[model samples]
Target: MIVLPWPPSVNTYWRTFRGRMLISAHGRDYRVRAVAAAVSAQRYGQAKVAVRIEAWVPDNRRRDVDNLLKAPLDALAHAGVYEDDSQIVELSIRRAGLDRANPRLEITVEGA
Candidate 1:
């Protein structure tokens, strides 16, 4: 498993650029951090894989878990964990309760 920082919400991940959308600063930073944290990860190449993400939120407030998938998946793709996010044949995310001092995601990728 690879431990990574919690990603920004999908709502904050993109910004309006004229009439187009672009990755916001927060999104870009998360991508960079994802790559850094995944340095020791084993690449999966083009193989189909299953990814399980365990999230520890800083608060007990409600949040949409699905909205957190894109950034980390994209970051993993960019980091060469697989050719693309499409290679993820299965994905799951769990709300692992609070961790105010160290809110994060623990990700596990396995061959499917």
Candidate 2:
């Protein structure tokens, strides 16, 4: 199980600057934070995995659930939580309503 701070949405995670797509400031910050959060994680190599994600959002604004997964998935892989997100064979995500004081994500990874 891992706990990560809220991540930037896909809309803000990438930017086009001078015709090149680059990671946005929000995305870079989120990746750093995500890596820090997973500092103690053990790599899963290429083993098949099942991941469950719970999101505690900051507000009641309507949002797409899947939009929140990308940054965290890539960041976690960069953190060595797993060899790659491709190793996930099963994935589940649920919005757990608001946690205004502590908007965050809780994720669990298990062998399939």
Candidate 3:
């Protein structure tokens, strides 16, 4: 299981969500994370991959960290990071807390 740190710039969101919107907005992050994980997996491997999110926003300010990682994941899929059989690819996202902690994004390719 190899861990990779995502670039800070990728987490930048100029728009802020208010009220229930914050929770729904989480979808964005989820997409980003998925894309990042996919690409990372393709470059590295698919069978093994995980994503850890370290958010800086206050707990109250956001609903779920998974939402923040979505875009990157979609990007990976769009970039064709999956395998031919699509059986050796895997992506997962785990949320921790708002800190300087290094979120570990793991990607593993089977039979690589």
Best by TM-score: 1
Please provide TM-scores, in order, for all candidate models, with all chains considered together. Answer: 0.96, 0.95, 0.32
Q: Candidate 1: misplaced stretches above 4 Å?
A: none
Q: What is the TM-score ranking, best to worst?
A: 1, 2, 3
lDDT of 1 by residue, 2-26 (tens): 8889899989999999999999999
Residue 103's lDDT within candidate 2 is 98
Model 2 quality (TM-score)? 0.95
Q: Report the lDDT of model 2 for residue 95.
A: 98
Better of 1 and 2 by lDDT: 1
lDDT value for model 2 = 0.92
lDDT of each: 0.92, 0.92, 0.43
* Tens-digit per-residue lDDT, 58-81, candidate 3: 333545555545444444445455
Task: Compose the digit string of candidate 2's lDDT tens values, residues 1-112.
Answer: 7999999989999999999999999899999999999998766878888889999999999999999999999998899888899999999999987999999999998887
Where does model 2 exceed 4 Å of error?
Answer: none
Q: RMSD of model 2, in Å? A: 1.0
